[model samples]
Target chain A: MIYMKRVRLFLVLGLIGLIPIMISGCLGSKTSIQALFTVSPDKQVIPFTANFDGTLSYDEAGRIVSYTWNFGDGTTGQGPVVAHMYKRNGAYKVKLTVIDSRGRTSVSSITVQALNPPPTAQFSYSPKSKLNDKYVVGASEWITFDASKSTDDGTIVSYNWNFGDDTVGTGKIVKHRYIWPGTYNVVLTVTDNNGGKTSYTQQVNILGGPPCNSDISGGDTTINGSQK
Target chain B: MKGLAAVVVLVVLMQVSAIAGGVGLFAGAGPGGAALGEINQAITLYNRLLDNFNHTPTITGNVPPIPKMGSGITYQAGEQFWITDDLALGGKIEYFRTSVATAGEYQSGGKKTPISIALDCSTIGFVLTSGFNFLHYGFTLGVHGGVGYYYSGFTSNITFSVPSGYNKTISVHPHTGKGHYNNRSLGLEVGLSMVYPVTTWLALGVDASYRALTAPRLVDAHGIGLDLDGDGTAEHINLSGISLQVNVSIKLDLFR
Candidate 1:
């Protein structure tokens, strides 16, 4: 009877020890939290705006309750996603941290690069000629082109001109003469140090000499022949 | 037909033994006799259908969806060892081949250019399977789950032609060498087999099974960009599909 009592006591103790293990198994497995995000337009010219998305972040056992963003430029934000603009050219490291309902946390990060903006191109020519509208000029007369009015955020490096008459020229101020009497289109292209270029075109109609011929016939002057 | 012939020969041998007072080479076999032997082998032919392909980036708003693969087929061989009366552990190797067609048009500057793309994809993989078999009078039903590594190879050709009367007519032909991607995923298989037991040492079975795997990302080889969800990144190819197969299995008692 004493031996039976000892066996029963041992059985009870073993069952008590197994209770916690069985309950834990029935409760299900625990999973670690995962954080994910994406940055749109990660590389662009300043001033640049980037959009961040952390909607893909997940918590295996619970829901994500909060999201925090640190835009390496020393600015912080709170949300599942946010947009930030960088005014200067530099590289910024963006980080996203997510907190689950169970107080578990995970972090993910990415790098964004911003570059200097391209220069704005502008130019104007002399004689105020409009290509779409008509402008008249004398044959064999010189037309002047000036690209000195062109502007850029950086230094203007070069100026190129297409005279539209199978001829080309280079300089800020250049002159070209059209020998034939027909409509011609002139184009001016300016380039900045950053390789940015802009072009302007104008049209001009050149007229030939007057249509009359004078001949002295037999020592007597007569205005007889029409212009050829 | 070859499987049928094998089954016929086995049945004839078993019948002869039965007529001779059942004192055959495989007589007096019990449940515990070589229970952990090679009990199943199969050869399967499957038909697979894939999801739609990724979209092209240049085409905007209301473009037709990308085309699906034209033909898909897989060949597989599997072997299993019986661990208990109703449980088995095994592995299977498979080879799959398929062809994809991509054709579209882009309109820019009042000109329409037609593009054609063709790709051939092949994959080889092996999976470890754990299954439970339920035995009836002459039929066995089973379900299995597997995890394995898969490697896929892709080769593609792209061509585009610009129409005449354009300021400049252009043609582009981009060649992509063989590209490969690898992944590990899980698969599920369920099958039913009819077992014709001819002798204690051999049986001929016919099986029909269905299998599926998780979809893996497929990268474009020609550098075509697609933003299907309005995200900046290109969308990946979808490879999720179901496969149906009919197999001829030969069950053997290797220990006997």
Candidate 2:
């Protein structure tokens, strides 16, 4: 009888212990809150704006009543979502804190990177004319390539040109003379101080002048030992 | 007086019979006669991460242009309690992640510089669902709906070679950073599942779900701002899509 009584006592104590655990598991839902969030376009070129949303933050058993944001730039905001713009290039840390209806809070954070914008490539050539007239040019004719129309956010430092006739030059405006008439390709490459570069290519046709000995060679050009 | 006493006794007996019937109904109700409770773990083949990063530009050949987001994977675990034969209430936790890389060259002043870019993203959250078992035969068909939280973000890294005209070569270092965002606007999810029971307690299932949430804005740790749409204001990232999952579930008969 005593052994049976001890077993019953142990069972009652075990059940009492389990009662608290079960109740806590079901009723303590709001005790742990997870503060979560996301940032769009996290990496960007300078003069950038970023958007922040904390709608994904959650309370385990309750509802989130408020959201607070710290932009890491000495700026703060209150809401479930917010937006900020960075004017310069650098790295910044953003943070979000969410409070549940039960006064429990959770925090989340991320890093944002902003870099200087790369130079844009834009250029125009002078003498806006087509090489369609027989696609021909006189021998020893001079052709000009002007890359002054190219633009960059920063100053353009240099221009390199390949005349496609075993010739190269350096300048914003370059002139090349083709001695033997043929089709030639002209290429221009522009570079900025930041090492940014862009290139453009144009085709030119240079027609060879009439052969100097066209008439003398056809009929009777023969050596003393050999005749045709 | 004798008739009143007899009527009272009859009413008492009827009440006892009704109570006994209610207890019998509760005892007989089970989850399709297989079990009264279940726990499931699933592996998800998710393609939605690709939609989230589709607009960010990356290095490609000679140009830096935007590329499509890549596919990803997720895992989830859930528990359900059947209150009756056909209806159940449950909750789940899900985790997802993805990563992608791009490389290209930037050319200028007759010189070419190599550039590389990479992105990594992850998410973790929970949801509560109400499910209905609509069909039962060789296989069981169930449908569910829920509201939950979705926490996600990405880390981006960019490296570029030093340009010409610098007296000293500046060592190229990768610029890496993370942006965190969240959606709390009552995220909604709907799913359909078909399960084939191998035994009384174990089942294999295929589940397809569609989830929708408010678009979250990405903000870097540095608190930098971005005007993605050029409207002079900041914009949010879109992180909504569908998921296909394969799951294994085990039924527990403790309640029954």
Largest DockQ belongs to which candidate? 1
DockQ of 2: 0.01
Identify the CAPRI category of the predicted complex in candidate 1: incorrect
Candidate 2, which segments miss by more than 4 Å at Cα?
A1-228, B1-67, B107-112, B159-185, B225-232
Model 1: per-residue Cα lDDT over A15-72, one tens digit each: 4554453343223122345456667778888887888877656664689999999999
For residues A85-202, could you state the per-residue lDDT of candidate 2 as single tens digits?
9876667888888888888886767787766555554434333344565345555544556676888777888877777877677777665556666777777777877666777787
CA error at residue A136 for candidate 2, angstroms = 60
Candidate 1 chain B: worst-modelled 10 consecutive residues by lDDT:
B40-49
RMSD per candidate (Å) reads: 16.1, 21.8
At residue B21, candidate 1 shows an lDDT of 23
Q: Provide the lDDT at B203 for model 1.
A: 53
Q: Tens-digit lDDT track for model 2 on B38-92?
A: 0000000011111212221331234243243435665678776554455555567
